[model samples]
Target: FTRQGQSCTAASRIYVHASLIDAFVAALREAISKLKIGDPLDEATDIGTVISQRQKAKIESYIDLGARTAGAKVDRCGELPGAAHLKDGLFLQPTIITGVPEDSPLMREEIFGPVVCVQPWDDEDDVIARANDSDFGLAATVWTNDLRSALRTVQRLDAGYVQVNQNLTIQPNLSYGGFRKSGLGKEASLEAMLEHFTKKKTVVIDMR
Candidate 1:
């Protein structure tokens, strides 16, 4: 998980098609297994500690919540740093969870840590609806090769920023922000300058 999944726009709720869910999870597990968990200063380390112990606990609570869910499966990879290496630092193993219900808090809340929830989708409309059901709609990604399907899904998604077959990449020239509870205004670009950073006023003298 990049930046320990701490970014606001992290791809947390991954909705894969029913046909690909199995293979997707398997590949994800394999990829996660190779991640090196250790000191942040170490070049060999792929993942480091979260910001603090409180954040570590918050993420662990979500993991526990997923485990307690009836059908949800919690998956983790790599080993925790040994005490000799850890030295009281806060770190969490990257986690990948599947079969969590849509209504569960794990799916609903913004868990700003190294945890992700994978769910399967069948119908296009249903998947789109499910994706938009959340209060947070900052960013979304559609990973389909079909142009038609990608365009269709992209246009319908409620996120302020949508990516096609790419990870979240915020560029300086592009307007960046979110919808609903994600945020109110934008950052970067001209739109943000006019709408968020600047105020507009009009005055008329008695020309008549």
Candidate 2:
């Protein structure tokens, strides 16, 4: 997002191998470029329909926000060929946007969809700042082979959960909740018990 000079909240994460920001970008480009938009039931489809026309419209608005508010440079929207067969389908192209600044309105909003924004950071501090600057603090993942970077990311990322070495963290013992508006409740484990429950004080000073 910094590239587009826009700001973003913690939507998702773009992890890198510490120093290879360029390589990470290249990989993201390749991965996003290859998504095939079509029917989910079809085994050949790489990408599938977005659910409904409202969802498609919502996703597109964010694209517009990225371009106008965040300064993100966007590629032309690709029309899915296979989806054309459907009379009224929710097929929308996968999008990859670059140049969103860490603090733009484009980055701060939550967009739950197939659109992935690949952002590069100079250091952990930079990523942490951008990651936390938002109203929604759902979840974030840090991908790194270095234990130190992973450790620090966990310590600094202001989210409810920080998954390391993987994009997802789903364990029975770990508790999950959002920092802001993303969510207010907790679930999964003992951690939730602490966050969700209120403590009661009982007095037992019976005239001893």
**Model 1 / residue 42 / CA error / Å:** 2.1
Which one is best on TM-score? 1
Give lDDT: candidate 1, residue 140. 95
Q: Tens-digit lDDT track for model 1 on 1-208?
A: 7889999889999999999999999999999988988899899898998998888889999999999999889998888888585878888899999998889999899999989999999999999999999999899999988999999989999998999989856888799999999887898798886898778899989988
lDDT of 2 by residue, 126-177 (tens): 6677778878776787776889877877888888776776644456777867
Query: How does candidate 1 fare on TM-score?
Result: 0.95
lDDT of 2 at 190: 76
**Which consecutive 10 residues in model 2 have the weakest lDDT in total?**
1-10
lDDT of 1: 0.90
